[model samples]
Target: MTSRSRPPRLRPLLLTVTLALALAAAGCGTEPAPDRVAGRSSSGDPAPDRAELEARASAAQIVAEHVWVTEAAGYALARQSVGVLGDDGFGSSYTAPDGGMLQLSVERRPHAEADCTDGSAAAGGSEPLWTCERDGEQWYRATESGHAYAREQGELVITVSGAREKVDRATLRSAARAAHRADDHELDQVLPPAGDASGRQPVERGDLPPMGDGAPNNDVGASG
Candidate 1:
């Protein structure tokens, strides 16, 4: 069978937006500049990683090009929740003050009108899709349990959803429309900070004998 039209994966897109959520617990993640990947410009201003902003995309496992983000009235991105969907697909959660939540995901997959009935429109076939409506470029689907807004952007399907009590149809629709590829600034806020690379240096231990190469500090002098 011939493959459907899907956008070629863009490389060097995210530096990887793990949503590194701790940076942003409030307000759609943190506004910290993209420090890790970017460098200072000639004007001394911090600039995006030359590779992301200036170079052409190449393939990688992160496939950060598929990562998308959105904005809603009171929802803030839960950076820690940002993660890969299936393979390189993007997924994240947005939270509100009342403990309400919204989920947004972008997948490199296909969904047509027929998929709605064949059960391919949702998580393989796990999500019960009972209601389907086409509104302009979006396809609104509702199951007995929940509802969501979905649209096909290139070869990817972007979706937004929330519990019925937490969010309304209009809100989900707005989120889906607002969803866009994470830009350099957003990537910085969304991607988790990287850990220091591995080295031979070992952590100093409190129990190790200071004078001996391999001995335990067993002296319990004063206290014992």
Candidate 2:
């Protein structure tokens, strides 16, 4: 007599169990942590090298030339450059020991017209802006949180701002007046010309790495 055949379903059930166990074993293998990857950092990553910081400082200096500081005493400067969609710009911030801050930014657009008449006039007791006869070039001063000045010169637009109590209107005006177009050399340093190989340039300051909170001061202002 034939032995009672094991239930037909038993074979498929055993195969299913074996497959699931195999998958479970595979899942148990350790995965590389994200921080372990190159150019990546977990909370425990090491601080930037001295050379890197120095390079950034040098770049900042190139940008800071356009920013005029009335008094260099009791203040430290931090600067950064940004390039996007063929437009290039730089930003700088001067921070005083007493929590005072002044920010400046300059942007260059090849296609933009330097026209101030289109800008809405700032309101109510605000310092009047100065307009130049050339292409309606002008400066606008606003007293919101503090004092801010925006000016356009040819293809360059510059803006300066400072804390109301800490910085005076004249200082802002002076900075605006001091703003000048970045020369080709400075632009090349900040935004290297694209290489012919791929018609693309290497990554620039625009790719500034994320500096997490709790590091040094966050005194650098946002780019205009």
Top of the candidates by lDDT? 1
TM-scores vs. true structure, each candidate: 0.58, 0.36
Residue pairs clashing in model 1 are 18-191, 19-190, 20-192, 21-79, 21-80
List the global CA lDDT of all models. 0.57, 0.39
Cα lDDT tens digits for candidate 2, 1-224: 88431110101122322332332344311221122111112335345454443344344333323422222344343322122212345544544546555555555644334343333345763443322222123344333344456655455556566655666666656555644443322333332223311212344453344565434443566772
RMSD of 1: 12.2
Question: In model 2, which regions exceed 4 Å deviation?
Answer: 1-74, 79-87, 109-138, 180-224
lDDT of 2: 0.39
- lDDT of candidate 1 over 1-224, digit per residue (tens): 99643222221112112232322343543322232222211244464583653222222234557767787777777655565567668777777666556677787865442344333335667654455666666767665546677777777877777666557888778787878887665554555544311211235888997676768777788978
How good is model 2 by TM-score? 0.36
